[model samples]
Target: MLSIRNLHASVDGTPILRGIDLEVKAGEVHAIMGPNGSGKSTFANVLAGREQCRVTQGEVHFQGHDLLAMSPEDRARAGVFLAFQYPVEIPGVSNIYFLKAALNAIRKYHGLEELDAMDFISRVKSKVEMVKMDEALIYRAVNEGFSGGEKKRNEILQMMVLEPALAILDETDSGLDIDALKTVADGVNQLRSDDRAFIVVTHYQRLLNYILPDHVHVLSNGRIVKSGGPELALELEERGYVWLNELTAGAA
Candidate 1:
């Protein structure tokens, strides 16, 4: 569903992603593991078309169209969803209103009629039940004063509501306890399907236990250095990233 080749990006004139090549097909989940400063988040931002991260060279095709050419809003409308590591709070906007507007916007982009209030509420409530989210939270301001777990669940709720084709979760496991982690992972797992894909970027392997990625990739120094199957995550857990760096150095 997504193809990236020799993708290079920079922020504030400082290079981060040197060259990234990845292909995500439908019905697959890929886990990107890396140490700090390895440009994992940068890669996700670039894919989402965040303006601060400029792509210097490369091409990204989403469903056969030029993905990098689209604006951030357009990308979101085109089914690219990024769940931020730290979800921001929009103090005054209730979550229900914000998500309804976003869902309607995407629907409108796809030439579908907007859901009226009653239908929209019914649809969102169903998803909330699926994710086991508290209905009360929907009436509150977006992410405002929510706990870390609540915020993460809120992100998944957004994903469930939008039903994006490609979901890039940037450290969604961060700051989550085991139960919270499982809850978030369960939400993601429930969304998996033959027509959707996931790119899970995380530092620890614990989250992989729940999400069960089909592929595991080690990213270092802005490039993906190794790719393997699910066992790769367990290997990384037993032997840290230093081992991968050493192996890369020896190979070089």
Candidate 2:
């Protein structure tokens, strides 16, 4: 569903992603694990078309379209979703209103009719239940007073409702307790289908235990040092990124 080749990105002319080449096929969940300053979040931001992180080199194609050439809105309309590690608070906008506007925008982009209020509410209520979110919270302003877990769950709720083709979750598991983590993971698991893909970026392997990625990649110095199956995550948890450092050094 997504193809990234020799992707290089920079912020203020300082490089973050040097050469990231990844192919995310439909229905595949790829976990990107790395230590601090390894460019995990930068890579996610780049994919999401954040303005500060400029693409210095390479190509990204989503569903055979030039993803880098598209604006952030175009990317989202094309079915690309990025769940930020820190979901921001929009004080004035009610959660339900924000969601409806976003969903309608994407639908409008694809020549589909917008969901009426009743239909949208019904659809959102089901997804809110799937994420185990409090129904009352949806009527309040978006993330204005939500707890850490609630904010994270809110991101998943957005993902579930949008039903994006490729979801880039940037440390969605960060700062979540085990219970909250399981709820979020369950929401993602429920959304998994034959044509959906996920790029899960995380610092530790604990999240992977629940989400169970099909592939695990280790990032060091902004490059993928090694990749393996799910077992690699366990190995990283046990051995840490020290071994991966050697692997990257060897490649250098």
RMSD of each: 1.2, 0.8
lDDT of 1 by residue, 16-118 (tens): 9888899999999999999989899999889888889999999999998899989899999999999998999999999999999999999999999999999
- TM-scores for candidates 1 onward, in order: 0.97, 0.98
Off by over 4 Å in 1: 250-252
Compose the digit string of candidate 2's lDDT tens values, residues 63-159: 9989999999999999999999999999999999999999999999999999999999999999998898999999999999999999999999999
Error of 1 at 188 (Å): 1.4
Which residue pairs clash within candidate 2? none
User: Which one is best on TM-score?
Assistant: 2
Give the C-alpha miss distance for residue 23 in model 2, angstroms.
0.6
* Predicted candidate 2, C-alpha RMSD: 0.8
